[model samples]
Target: MATIYDVARLADVSAKTVSRVLNGDGPVGARTREAVQDAMAKLGYVPSNAARTMRSNRSGLVGLITGAITGAQESARPFGLPDLLIVQGIQRVMASRDMTLMIADTGGRADRVPHLVRTFLEHRAEGLIYVAEYHQQIRLPQVPDATPLVLVNCFDDAQSPAVLPDDRQGQHALVRRLVAAGHRRIAYLTLRADMEATPLRTAGYQDALAEAGLPFDPAIVRIGYQSDEEGEMQLLWDAIDDLLRLPEPPTVLCCGNDAMAMRVYGILRSRGVRVPDDMSVAGYDNHRIIAETLYPPLTTVELPYAAMGMKAADRLMSLIAGQGREEPAPTLVTGPVLWRDSVVERRAATLQSISL
Candidate 1:
């Protein structure tokens, strides 16, 4: 029921002086500041943020659209939910900037994106971020030309600015590490051929092998995972059986993700293959819950979900600041590899040219 003017009147100070004290933008004596504060407490006065937003023409609100909040379908990228990590990363940055974040969950439905977008527009969000369930190309409905938008874990045919994980680099680093540990006969079980990361990560595997002066053997690599689809388990077992039946069995097996690697462990045990003893293993997506809880623990490369979110938020903020009008090239972020007891150190890591 009270306003800044009431507090100013009771404090016997000019409205402008009271404002200076409240905003801490201009010089005000300690006694005047104390009197203003005391008057505000007495009057139970509270500043209206809505009025401030109207005056500044800045909502200080960022809109994020994702299906991760209420849970989405499990994807092959990570064994667990990665969208939550990405959202948490974005929230950290927005909070540090003193900006509010408005999130909308579509219950894992892409068809509902347009509605979320309109809701954010109605709120006058200064910037917007779209977080995908996985790394892939996306086609969005038409958004306002003036609205700054950034994509995380995905890109578009329109060449919109986006932040994506460095799939090639991450796989390359993992393979290179394997090679350095003297894993000459390493078998790779990859995601389905249709997935975007499959080709890039395969290329990385080959790159690392070539760098280590090892020959590329197609027989060792096989499609081992799909989008949690039926018949996916059969594909994995077949790949594992083929690898084991080879005359020259692999010293290590690298899987598409932590979940697959976990499955691989069980399969190998059932078939009398002891990890890091008879064979070693590696995985992608350093999902701590599965990786850390495994018997010997998992050695894997991070998917960089959190880092991608931060980069996406930063890019969106830059666009909102009017940095440029041209569509930006997708930014690539790489994550580190974690070493664990799942791998046997046949030798010290010796590859020098191998870079992540």
Candidate 2:
């Protein structure tokens, strides 16, 4: 392996000059910087991170604790690999930095977190990010006060700085759009009531209804899927059946996530219901694979998965730079509602009620 000294010799510069160029500590002229880079590339010289760490007193390391990749979440989320998008976003932002991300999977066990935290602390990771497979509240094993940490897709009661999806806002926006497109009597089939986002999204749904001067009708709302429960398909199907049997059936079915919407499509079709023509549908968590590939393409709300990850990384970077981790409210990131062919604009919308 070619060393800095070798690079310096090839570039016709002193070792100090080469070190300056490598670290970007003190400025070297643009031409000199270019020459040093060319020489290092020609010699296939790789800079020593350890040496750089020694000089800067920063390991340039960020530790990520996640279970999304391992599918080891508190429970299965309706969203198909949402945390994966978040992790990818974090990677995208950090990729430009001279840092390394060390990941530790909890293997679906929360107890493993402390051990992983200790391992990262031992390695002197400058910062840490904890990502959950779904949006929820969590209590992580204690980390040091000085160590910079950011929570993603989850938050705790302690009000630690976190990057989170604006569940309420996303749901509100999607519902508002549905209302705009002349959907009255929208039936909401939501995730289990226990999930953190459920209540928030429900509130958003109600908000849109109230905004449109519609009454809050709990009778039309039902649990479509449970994160902790199996046989969710039966639960979702029952909800759909219940809605269809209502005296004033909904014109549109809004699902908790794209996966559920996909299932709703099959259920509606099997029951001889034509989507959009008979009943329109909308979902949350615009998982493109499901949303775009669906028969008419789904109209859904996107959770800022990748954007949350990027924001978390940005926050972690700030924290690592000696920015005090003040106990600020969690940063809520919102995503847009994607309009697709799955929804049809009612020509003569009956404000009275919309029925399939």
Candidate 3:
């Protein structure tokens, strides 16, 4: 393994000069830089990350800690696609900047956050990004006053920057579409009310109902855990049964995610109910499998995972570059809706029945 010393010997420059060139800490003559580059290429010299951190106290590495709840019995893993997309975006930006990433999964292990932050600090990470599997309020570990930090799909104190989807706007848009298709008795199946995204989406549901002059029926709103598939299925089944027994059941069911929607689809199918024709369904996060492969494709909101990741990385980089100003503010991104085959115009009889 070629080291910085090897490159220095080949380039006939002091190790400090090589370090300066690598860290961009000081200017090196163009010819000198070219010689160093040439030597690096010839020797297959890979700079020692440890030495670089020692010189500048900057790791040139970013830390991404994810707090995803994989054990939940939900329709799907909540953070899978968004986390992947965010990482892709972050990598896109980091690659251009010659930075590397160190990712850690917390698995909802909130207590380990302080230790994780310390570990990244020991590694001399220039910045940190904390990603939550779902949008929820989080209490972050106490970090160094100088270290730049950002949050993805979650928020903390006003001092840190965060980037997440605009759930309220996305849900509102989805509900409006259902109303346009003449769906009045709309039901919403959501995660626990305590979850951050749930309230935002629930607010959107109410907003659409108000706009359409439809009465808000609490009975049609159901909430459950997001931890596992069996629990999710059971909760959804119970919600569906309750909704079906209503004097006039909803013609539209809007789910918090593709996972839940898929479960609902299975329950409905098993009960001999046809999709769209019998009940229109929509969901958020637009999980690829559910959107593309389901018997009746799902209409869903596409989370701007990549964009959020890119923005979060950019913001963190800006902070690291000393370009950040004032305390960090929460950032929200909006994803476009993907229309699919899961929804249809409410039949005249269905509409009449709900009205009666």
* Candidate that scores best on TM-score: 1
lDDT of 3 by residue, 88-150 (tens): 788788888888988876766788888889999887888999887668778886888788889
Q: Write the per-residue lDDT of candidate 1 for residues 198-294, one digit (tens) a residue.
A: 9999999999999999999999999988666457678888989998999998899999989899888988999999987988989888889889999
Q: Go through the candidates in order and give each one's C-alpha lDDT.
A: 0.87, 0.87, 0.82
Candidate 1 runs further than 4 Å off: 5-9, 12-30, 72-81, 324-327, 348-356
Supply the global lDDT for candidate 2.
0.87
Output the TM-score of candidate 2. 0.85
Q: How do the predictions measure up, each by TM-score?
A: 0.88, 0.85, 0.82
RMSD of 2: 4.0
Residue 74, candidate 3: Cα error in Å is 13
| lDDT for each residue of candidate 2 in 1-356, tens digit (9 for 90 to 100) | 99999999999999999999988889799999999999999999998988777777789788999987677344444455457788889998888776788888888889999999999998889999999988888998888988888999899887778988899999999988888888778999998888999999999999999999998889889999855435778898788888899999999999998998998999999999998899999988888989999999999998889899999998988888877567476999999999999998874556445554
Q: Candidates ranked by lDDT, best first?
A: 2, 1, 3
Worst 10 contiguous positions by lDDT, candidate 3: 67-76
Model 3 earns a TM-score of 0.82
What clash pairs does model 2 have?
Answer: none
